[model samples]
Target: MHGTALSGWLLVAVCTATGAYCLLRLRSDCARARSSAGGEAVMGFGMAAMAVPAAFAEPPSWLLAGYAGVFAAAALRAGWLARARENGGGHHLHHVIGSLAMVYMALAMSAPGGHTAHEGHPGAAGGVPLVTGALLVYYVGYVLTTGARLLPAAVTPRGGGTLAWRARPELTLACRLSMGIAMLAMLLAL
Candidate 1:
């Protein structure tokens, strides 16, 4: 496999793992799981479409339009949710930006003329660079900040059954880190 395909497959793997885990976690915590299930599904499906090999090639135009429409709708819904709740925090902002980044990626893949699919082509013109750059910066910062948050020692639990990191969701953090890496890979592929 070439570099592009390899990156795409790796991204798919990350997203698939995230989506599956999110679904499983949903059984345990309905409210928290409800918020992320749709996003995770989109991530998995989008990455899978991107990762499909040439031997079983699907048209880029189709994939691009589908992903663009899905993510655009998702962004709009997220915006309305934010507005209804008197707005939210970085989580809401990240969802909006992430959806936009996917939309940008889809459009970049669907550039007019005879340009080939994948990044590093003339297809990546227009707003692709700016959007991809912003996403890369944001994900990188998130990973770093999250890592920093993990560094400070929490008060040690006294009881034998106590969990020190009760508030932190390790699985979700792992998924976020994987997504961050996937975002970096996608931008680099560009």
Candidate 2:
């Protein structure tokens, strides 16, 4: 593969690995709480929504269709969680926003005239600007919100003093930063 292609695959690999870590962490939390697997599953699905595009960079038409299906499912789950009376465990709104960002990346990859599409062409001036701007905003929001939630969790003690370090806080921050950088890279690539 060419350098660009290699870089693309690397991006996919990073995203999928991080997403997997997040899924496992949530699963462990579920196990600890003795709760149903529903919440963990939903979060896993959201992370999977992100991994789909990354894992299938030059996917066949059917693969893209599958990506669309997963994204739809993720969106439904996010909406349901949003309407819940009390959000719990993870940061519901922030995850929803991050999920939406993944949706944007997937859509951008599949959209007509996008760089990755078969019949791709340069987008209209305004179109590229609008989409890229929105994506940047989305990642920034993801970073800020996830960071805010993580600060306390990483610092607060469970019984009396905080743990040395918290995985969720660290991972959440890393994900946010990487996503923001990825968004910038995408904009520059455009």
Candidate 3:
């Protein structure tokens, strides 16, 4: 969701591309990579759908409710995965937060007197301003941290050949950073 149609379309494209790349990451041999990629794929596609310009199609209330329900379930699943004694539990924990934020945003949009009128203004949605602000802060910090992690580093590449890019950790980090920035934009629109 954005003020302008062009920005909305851009967001959708970014998210869709990120989702497609994450789907490619599913071929990774590492279980943790596959699992995290699965969750990220869902988030990417979901964000794309939600970012559709209201001018083209204003989703019905029931659909918004469905979004809330689906993301809630995803949040629960992520919470469970986060508790497991796995090396990538941190990634699952981040997914939990991201899913819950999506749920919150969907609910906010579905609520009466929500973003129906002020489609692009911050705090226009029906959620508590503090909560929205908190999510915005979290996503901003996530974007910054992920972006920093993407800085040039001296290290041997793990994967090789034509298919190697699909499993590159740097690519995954870049994908996460893009999504984090998109999330920030969505929250600001809210």
Candidate 4:
């Protein structure tokens, strides 16, 4: 419990950095950077929220509700994008899962005592950290696998348009990895 706060703050930093990076990249002339801006921002914000006080304190009710609501909408949007075939199969799928995961974490964190890491903690959500554990495992695997892809020589491309960001596999993947790591930190605190 004592060490958890440090990790929690670290996660907060990670998420804040990611968010700032994504938003800043969006300003670049490269449309490739701008394309994923919205998604990355949302991921950053969600992870930041989940990381803070993940193991101990309850988030404000409005914050919990707002976080869940926004993510729920993102989930729905992901579902729609998937249906409309607007995004890549893997990326869109991640969005769908990530959005749902956010909602789950929000509600789980907002539970009686906001102690989801240890399901047995006071006000535990179902007294089972099954979802949290599953998300943790998923993020770990994703981060490892994605890191492997980064081992190859990579080049940032230039493009201008809404879809340009899709061309920058490195940035997009890095955003995903950072977000996954942030979520992992939060889950660990739970």
Clashing residue pairs found in predicted model 3: none
List clashing residue pairs in candidate 2. 157-161, 157-162
Evaluate all candidate structures by whole-model CA lDDT and list the values in order.
0.61, 0.49, 0.86, 0.68
> How far is each candidate from the true structure, as Cα RMSD in Å?
4.4, 5.5, 2.6, 4.6
Across 18-94, the per-residue lDDT of candidate 2 in tens digits comes to 55555555544433322212433443444434333333455454655565566566666756666654554244454
Report the number of clashing residue pairs per model. Answer: 0, 2, 0, 4
The weakest ten consecutive residues by lDDT in model 4 span: 158-167
Q: Candidate 1 clashing pairs?
A: none
| Model 4 residue pairs with clashes | 32-164, 32-165, 117-190, 118-190
The better-scoring model by TM-score among 1 and 4 is: 4
Model 1 C-alpha lDDT versus the unseen true structure: 0.61
Query: Between the candidate structures 2 and 4, which one is better when assessed by lDDT?
Result: 4
Q: Write the per-residue lDDT of candidate 4 for residues 58-116, one digit (tens) a residue.
A: 56778887989999998777676666444444565677788888888677656665554
Q: Which TM-score value belongs to model 4?
A: 0.76
Q: After superposition, how far is residue 173 of candidate 4 from its true place, in Å?
A: 2.5
Candidate 4 deviant stretches above 4 angstroms? 1-3, 27-35, 54-58, 116-127, 154-168
TM-scores for all candidates: the values are: 0.74, 0.61, 0.91, 0.76
lDDT, candidate 3, 1-99, per-residue tens: 546889889999999999999999999998989988988999999999999998899889899999988889889888888888574889898999999
